[model samples]
Target: MSERKVLTKYYPPDFDPSAIGRTPKHLRKQGPKVITVRLMAPFPMKCTNCGEYIYRGRKFNARKQTLEEKYLNIPIYRFFIRCTRCSGEITFRTDPKNMDYECEKGAKRNFEPWRDSKSGKYNETEEETLDRLEREENAEHEQQERDKMAELEEKMHDSKREMAIADALDEIRTRNARIARNEGKDDEAALDSIHEQVDESLLQAEREDEEAARKAFMTANGERIKRIVEEEEEDPVPTAAPVSAQSKPAASISMPPPSSTSFSRVKKTKKSGNLLGIKKKPSLV
Candidate 1:
């Protein structure tokens, strides 16, 4: 067999390449060989092997593959990618439960804590629910701290009240003790003054009685002596006067001799007169 060669190359001025016929819209067009779907990646990713960073919102030409897993009657899909630097295989899958693409292996995404947003109510996702749960936990913790602080404050207030009451009681006790001491001193002073007055009155009464007795004794002695002398001069050698038996027995007399002389006994049958009164003395003249 010989290789045949032919050549005729020319372009007409009226040729329009866009005039070619295309398939009708109603007919089913052939599907593309490279199936692509937009993915939402809200965080940066780093390759596990090469530590290469893939920034957020980056576009990647990933090859799609079917997964055996199914959720809620929807078939799961997987995508395989390669690291730009190391060309290491990276893979991710669609998560129907969380409604986001999850890295199956070979890469790590920056951790992002969940939070609620303005559109969370309309287009709520699993992240929104997680955010609500986190908020509830935080609120519970704050409430607990507030309760502990309130309890501590109450204890402090009670302690302050107790201290105040103790101080008051101590002050009252001291005041009562001082008052009792003053009263005791006053009683002692009063007792001493009363005792002194009583002693002085008793001494004064005793002195008055002694003076009256002395005066009475002196008066009686002078009168008795003068009367005895006159009676002796007038009744010298006079006979003794008679007296009642009861009165004579109750009386006796003793006197000093004025001058020495002889004396005679009276008759035994006659009763003696009161000797200290005006009795006659028998004299030897």
Candidate 2:
């Protein structure tokens, strides 16, 4: 047989075990009430599945079960209600400590994937999602605007380069035109100078020819005058003959008449200053 164990405590020696059934008057004095929890049977008022309003005093033979989860220490009560109208079965659960009820099918006692621990609700709403999409769209639009600005700058650069090239071409063309004009002017001036030279040469040649012809005429006239003077110097000189006395000199002669009239010729003579027969007298003499 198994032996029974006895417990002893320090108290009055006259204490009896039967006296414990009666409470003391001073201990029975009322004090502040305390809150306690109780798990009671479900009310028989309404079956959410059956849609039948069962009377409060009536008894319902409903099935009850205890559901437990790893995160919760308290047991949950599950009630299965059967509908008399459509024979539909509905289950309901209750948290005995909290006195909270939930539909068995719709009860979300497990870990919710959509809820956030901080906000205590599901994910972002439709408005928030739309706002995010709009923000992304605006960012893309800004990027496009930046690209357009860059493209415009490139086009402007090209335009400036092209404008500069066009200006340079115009300057070159203008310079060339000016040079051509100057060359044309120079050519005209050169032609005029050549004409002036040609005219001067022709005039000089005409003057020279006239001078030569005048000099030749003078030389021929000088030769003819020299020939005439030389012929005159070579001719012989003539003298007068003396008159005879026989014919007419009887009266002119001083002497008597010659015997038997036979006349004797008398001679006359003249003297020159030079012996070489060249003239020595001056032109004035």
Candidate 3:
């Protein structure tokens, strides 16, 4: 171990360094540059050489090489792997256009339902596929144009409806203002009429009170005059003493008492006449 680790080594005194010969350039190996790599299977496939199945994600020691073909300037690479069961060679290459791998020889890839569905291919001719694509694009453009026109028409209709609603609101507000003003005038007139009626009623009440007072005064005055006349009729009148003997003898000659007829006549006269000197018709006996 110590001799192997040493940087310097012993040499024979008789050795000659110039006797060795070099190979010619034409005799050197020539081929495409290939490199060994570790990778997993990209997809499930079956080997044609040995009828062996290879599943995706299986690790392998593969030989990778750059290919002559390219897609849109992107380089494509080919890989060679051997089957695990029979050690048969399998070749596949990168497909940049589809972003997937393609089997070239020695193996066949399994069918993929998802890939077929996405490509929408049914083994149709090239011309038919092109026509279908063009028709689809035209239909899409027409649909977009129709949508834009419909949106524009809807906006115009909304603007017109809004304008009409605003006009109606303005008319309604103006009418309401006019009605309010008229109602105010009517209220003022009603107040004036009510005041006039109250004043008339007050005047009528005053007139009635005055007439009632006058009638009461007349009734009281007439009652007082009637009482005075009744008192005078109830009292008897006294005669004066005879001044001379002849008058004494005349008074002594018992004058026949005044007749009841004469007293009745005075009473009737007093009752028939008033202080105002108006005569009343005699009452029936």
Candidate 4:
């Protein structure tokens, strides 16, 4: 907790705002709330010069006045207890709040004597004006520092925003690159598929050409065999013709004697399908 600063003003014993109309005149003065009371007690007082004991309440007059010291908050009523023996005066105060008497001058209070002395000594010169000016300068310096801190904070915020924007731009670039890479990948896949389709079409064309060549060769071989068979059947062997052979020589003509093509054809027929046996010739035809 922060300690409150004591104001530089002297307050007497009986200033109380709460007791405005109810307090007595002695207790309603403009001062502190505590007061000290003094009594003329017939006590023995020792003289410091002669070392003689002097009885109090003698013809030596004692002055009872409140001593407004620098440190004491409550007005200390110093009884100048004088001794008629050697004109020696001993001063003491009665503490009214504690209801105790103390001979010691040094008492503890919230008021600081050093601070009071400093203020008093400075008030006597031009140093008070300098102190006020210094206080103003310190306040202005603190305000400047606060402004500098605020400016630095604003710069930091701007920097953070710039960094965020830069990061967003970087992310956008990355996304675009990724999208372009995906497009490239798609294009590559499509090209690969197109190349595969072309290769398949070429392979199919080769297969079709192969089949066509095989079929054409087979057709040519069949036509050549048919022509050879027709030529061999038209030219019969020289022999006496039978009556049925003279009427239909070409129909009754027999095939030529077995060569390589004929034997292969006969073997292919036997290998390929079921065949029926021919009837035996009756005569030379």
Q: What C-alpha lDDT, on a 0 to 100 scale, does residue 251 get in candidate 1? A: 46
TM-score, each model?
A: 0.29, 0.23, 0.47, 0.24
lDDT of 2 by residue, 116-198 (tens): 35662234556776787799999999999999999999999999999999999999999999778667777778678779999
C-alpha lDDT of residue 220 in model 4: 43
Q: What is the descending TM-score order?
A: 3, 1, 4, 2
lDDT of 4 by residue, 136-210 (tens): 999999999999999999999999999999999999999999778767777778679779999999999999999
Best by lDDT: 3
* Angstrom error at residue 154, model 4: 4.7
**Could you give the C-alpha RMSD of every candidate to the true structure, in order shown?**
30.1, 42.7, 30.9, 32.1
Poorest lDDT segment (10 consecutive residues) of candidate 3: 223-232
Estimate every model's Cα lDDT from 0 to 1.
0.76, 0.62, 0.84, 0.62
Candidate 1's C-alpha runs over 4 A off are 1-42, 115-285
Error of 3 at 160 (Å): 3.0
Q: Give the clashing residue pairs of candidate 2, or none.
A: none
Query: In model 3, what are the clashing residue pairs, if there are any?
Result: none
RMSD of 1: 30.1
Tens digit per residue, CA lDDT, model 3, 1-285: 688999987878987656658756697787767999999999999999888889999999999998777777999999999999888889999976557888999999898887685565654556877898899999999999999999999999999999999999999999999778667787778678778889999999999999887676666546422333444456666787657756565546666788768656443344535777897888999
